[model samples]
Target: MKLLMFIKELTMLIKSLRGLCLCLESGSGDKLSNCTKQHIQKLLKANMMGPYGSEWAVEEKVKRREMVAPQARYIFVYWNANEMMDNAFTPLLGFLHFRFTLEEEIPVLYLYELQLDSSVQGKGLGKFLMQLVELIAQENRMGAVVLTVQKSNSLAMKFYISKLRYVVSSISPSRVDPLVGVEKNYEILCKTFDHEAKAILEVYSVQYRTARRVGFMAAFSDLKFED
Candidate 1:
């Protein structure tokens, strides 16, 4: 079956560009309009290595491919038409992969990955793409938008937490059992759209904070990190 394509255009100030002009294209795995899976894979491999070192990157790449390849319908590809390289049709600035699912029985949009080229990292593209995702969720009547972030990636954590107003999910693995989950490297984060979803999600965040406090006290009661 041929997948439907949705193209959205917006104006933004890019460091390398003269004026506001960006395009977001959405398509399924079978019908990528102007790019290929290889292109997306290359972008992912290039941008997803800061937090996760090269040791398990190959394995992780495979896992990511498996997740996104099957559900490309939710992939949002960001293109910069003016920065094309030799023989390339469009400059692949970044992409967002997500899907709709039930989180705590609440229908939500789960963002799998949002990656941008190093050249385009700090130019507001990230926030623009994220806002677009929330718009997508709201249009579909989803209760919330969710994503996971690596704890070690302080830049990303700050972006999501401070700029995007996302909070660590109450039911995130680490929050659920901090003592045992203390070794986890990632945290699930979310942004809810409605009063009902906000109330439901806030309960989890409060519970998690309480649990984390207890865990922190217990963890430091016997041991300490030496400087």
Candidate 2:
């Protein structure tokens, strides 16, 4: 309810200011009066709120969404309606959600909200995002980059597995989709980062499952080593 009020307030404020600006520009006063300037400032504040509020909303949402954690930075293909130096963004589809975040010891490039407008699907932007993911992962000293693909999406599954060296880490094996009346299996892909971390997240996952759960949680609670 509060958010709704804020949106309404901002919308009304923007509408009023735009009208005021048009009125002033047409009048004898070629320069903005104090009141007009203040009104313009309010418009500016509303414009600025959009960006900051979007960020805060994302931060708040990340808490509830099933997402990899510690995503402190978010870079985009289209940050604003305008990027630096007035360079018009490439027309290949917008915001691939090709965003990633480096977790404590791993980095995962999530396919956030990918859509190529059905026109640019065949283009190589998807490949470019994967390549960027690998570069960023290595730079961050993270283990392996992980991602998931649906069994029905055979083409995408193949793209990750064959091109990016991602291997299937887990499978649902039983999600026979009700609509399709066919089987649906989710494949979890993990490209063994440098071979060792790959072995750890995989081997550790398996070993941890069989592991005694009694005192294990406490042992990893802190990694600090002290005699």
Error of 1 at 14 (Å): 11
After TM-score superposition, the amount by which residue 127's alpha carbon in candidate 2 deviates from its true location, in angstroms, is: 0.6
For each of the candidates, the C-alpha root-mean-square deviation to the true structure, in angstroms, is 11.0, 17.6
lDDT of each: 0.71, 0.44
Best by lDDT: 1
- Candidate topping TM-score: 1
What would the TM-scores of all predictions be?
0.73, 0.46
Off by over 4 Å in 1: 1-20, 30-35, 58-64, 74-90, 205-227
Measured by TM-score, how close is model 1 to the native structure? 0.73
State the displacement of the C-alpha of residue 169, model 1, in Å, after optimal TM-score superposition: 0.6
Q: Write the per-residue lDDT of candidate 1 for residues 2-37, one digit (tens) a residue.
A: 112122322222233434356667766555544456
Q: Residue-wise lDDT of candidate 2 within 54-164, one digit each (tens)?
A: 354553344223222233222223222433345453322322233455422445554433223233345555565465555555555556666656565677777887877
